[model samples]
Target chain A: MKTDSEIIITLSDVWKSFGTQTVLKGINLSVIDGKTTIIVGPSGQGKSLILKHILGLIKPDRGQVLFEGKDINAIQKKELNEIRTKIGVLFQNAALFDSMTVFDNVALPLREKTVASESEVREVVDEKLSLMDLRGSNDKYPAQLSGGMKKRVGLARALVLNPRIVFFDEPTTGLDVALSNEIYRFFFKTQEKLKYTAVIVSHDVPKIFKLADYVALISDGVIQDCLSPEDFQMSSNPIIKNFVEATMGTIYSSEAMEV
Target chain B: MLNFVEKLGAYVLYYVNEAGRMGIFLFFSLLNIIKPPYNKIASVLKQIYVIGSLSVFVIIFTGAFTGMVLGLQGYNTLTKFGAEGLLGSAVALSLIRELGPVLSALMVTGRAGSAICAEIGIMRISEQIDALECMAIDPYKFIMAPKFIAGIISMPLLTALFDVIGIFGGYAVGVGLLGGNAGAFFSSMQSDVEFIDVYMGFVKSVCFGLLIVWLCAAKGYYVHLERKGGFGAEGVSNVTTSAVVLTSVSILVMDYFITSMLI
Candidate 1:
């Protein structure tokens, strides 16, 4: 077994396709423990696809996805589930079950997977909700919450498991400035407190650069570069420079439209 | 014209392949049902609400009206033979043995079954189901099992409710409107109908319920990965409508075999 400080997730020359159109041409990257790796790219550059591959939601057509050096694609379904339990995901739309109350939504993963008593599940859920300052909203349904509140509840649900790895897919996509800042602060605090490795897929260049230790810039079905966020900023690559500069004008640009 | 024909042929071939994949998905779900990791109470409860409780009104309204119309028509035919008293037996027997369950299953398929397909389809499109898969929760256990069980349990119960309410509706039309004796109507129904008649309807309903849930969920789940073209809202809508229409047609087709066996 690798040490705790070693890379937890490694993707080697992974390829994915939808029909003849290749999305991830060949993605190679490693995510180390206790560090946040942000994947920034033009929209539809397969950033979300990479996140899905790590989660084992989709298997690569070629190459390997290694979690702690074991090939995820070759593992049995039950064992793969065991691997998945260690990772938490925050969807772009928050994706909370609209039919359920907030407490039940946050408690879903624990209640579904484990034999935890309702009281125990509630205790854990309440703790996470309180951490996100979402205490009183437990009785509310997802439809009742504003966009920021939904994201907070989504984060609380992701944290309820205390997963070893967490993925945030555009966590601040539609939030107001103040709420977005709050979400960013929550990310930093949660990472520091839990020391969990995070993979964030975002076009929010400033926030990602500020918060991520390692950043991978993908363009045209290939990872253009993967470097320390500081190093990425200092590089003269026109693709990276255009992306970083474009982030300042608008959160999304017309050029980044998925082909 | 050749290009158009080629595209049409390719589209039909694509759908045929999708149906094959959906068959494989159901086979796996059936396998999961017999194996371990059987905890699916939450999903079952959700399905009970979505498939059972939400479907009651439409079933009842349709059942009542279909019974009344059968009474009206059966009364007209029986009157020519001076067999007006056979109206209760005719309506109850047809409703309990065939129309009640079949009609209720059809209506519920249109209402709840379509919704289930659309909901799961949207989830697939949004990557929410994938999120669940990554969490190590078996999508079959977390999503499919509860719905399967709920469909099996609820469809028969709903049909039974339809049978009862439908008989009452026939009674209202025959005795209250057509001036037939209430006592005679009840006696005729009691004399003609057996527990086996009820049993046949319930059996058919259970099978149809399983088909609806399995086909709808399978279509939604498999359609996403199998989509050869670009994935979008159009793909979801196409699958959802096809699921509803296909399940409805299958219910009718299967109803024939079920009725023949029981007869």
Candidate 2:
């Protein structure tokens, strides 16, 4: 939707498959800068696979994942790491380090990546956890927290570095509707302050789109539609129509309202 | 028939790949150990605590019993040969050259090797490893090198402890319980058991330490997730089993080659 916007990453003619099943087939997509691009898809579809390519976690069998005009596959290890520092990812499972407490888990990036003093780390961690509504849970371990709390802590960790971009994998998974909306508002407020692009993939279609500047739906190893939420809701494609209908029961477009 | 050949070929290739991969892993882990910022003192000590200190009781238990059995058996055999004065030499040589290192290796393999495999494998499946990569921390250097360095340092120390305890256990049984002369037992041991025998045990202990820690970390790191026993809890368990079994058998097999060469 933001065609003139600067693109952070582009997947051109990319293809991937697992064993006998093809997951991504000749995909072409671009992520606009400073805006939220929600990659909405069915469960077990190639959304995570696409996210992996963007993060340079996995290379496509064909084509390329280009980040800031450089092919992630062709970049040297040092160069790739330089690119990685600018990006943060929230995995589907939160993936907190079990050996460390919640405080240590969030403090890991600061300790590992920066030369900040212990007091500085404590101060940053305190602010981030407070923003994520996880101030008092620092002493607890990841194993003891609920899924939603883990997701919040993961968000805090991701934002602690204030990377230029962050990827959220199912950020609203276990939380109720109210909590998901509250988390979204919190994330937006942080985004407004921090000014970073975010790309998220979620199955929580209707509620998740509330934060999206663009919604891209992938199915059958191809992206079927990439449009604004209103345009996506009015997509003529049957797959998108069925998905939107199933998740929303009924769809009304702003364009239709304008008409 | 073609399918069967293809399957056989694939299995063989898989093993060859794994072998080559393990070889590279060992090389890198050891290489990173010497080349670095050199600030792993805390991590190395933590590993030593796990690999050396925590494993004391088991090592001592194994050493004591092996020595007691040797004392009884050696005395019985030497008396029949009219060489009862040689009992201490026989027990000392046996403990210092073979039982001490081999039993310590096996016990450490069970106590520490399986644990290293499970911990690394769990980290892999849970995306903690990926998180480390995302954070630009090399899991190999950060996670594995300490285990290797600690194992190399601790195995010999543990083996020496085992040897000492076994000899004492032999003294307890032979000199106090049995009718062997304490002077002959202690004096004969002092004269007959040279420094070389104890040196051989130390060398073997170091080798076993390298094999156990390296193989366990490699197995856990590269446990193939695409295969049935390659992901999740089942995968970690399977890899841990293989690491312990493979490392134990490897130590035993290499012990023969090493002994053959040394002797």
lDDT, candidates in the order shown = 0.84, 0.87
Stretches > 4 Å off in candidate 2: A1-5, A252-259
How does the DockQ of candidate 1 come out? 0.56
lDDT of 1 by residue, B1-263 (tens): 99999999988988788778878778877777777867457667878888999999988898888888887888888999999988889999999899988898999889988888887887788666776775676778777877888899899989988988888888888888888778878899999999999899989999999999988888788666544432578877888888899999999999999999888
lDDT by residue (A9-35, candidate 1, tens digit) is 899999999778999988988888878
Error of 1 at B108 (Å): 1.3
TM-score per prediction, in order, is 0.90, 0.94
lDDT of 2 by residue, B1-263 (tens): 99999999978887888888899999878877887755359889999998899999999999999899999988888889999888888889999999999999999999988888999899889888887787666776788889999999999999999999999888878877888988999899999988788789989999999998998889999876424468878889988998899999999999999999998
Number of the top DockQ candidate: 2
Docking class of 1: medium
Clashing pairs in 1: none
**Candidate 2, residue A244: how far the Cα is off, in Å:** 1.8
Q: What is every candidate's alpha-carbon RMSD to the true fold?
A: 4.6, 2.2
lDDT of 2 by residue, A1-259 (tens): 3453388888899999877888899888889999899998888888988988887778899999988889999989879888888888788888898988999999988887788999999999999999988879989999899877888888888888999999998888788877788768778878998999999989986888889999999988888878999888888788987788777875353333454
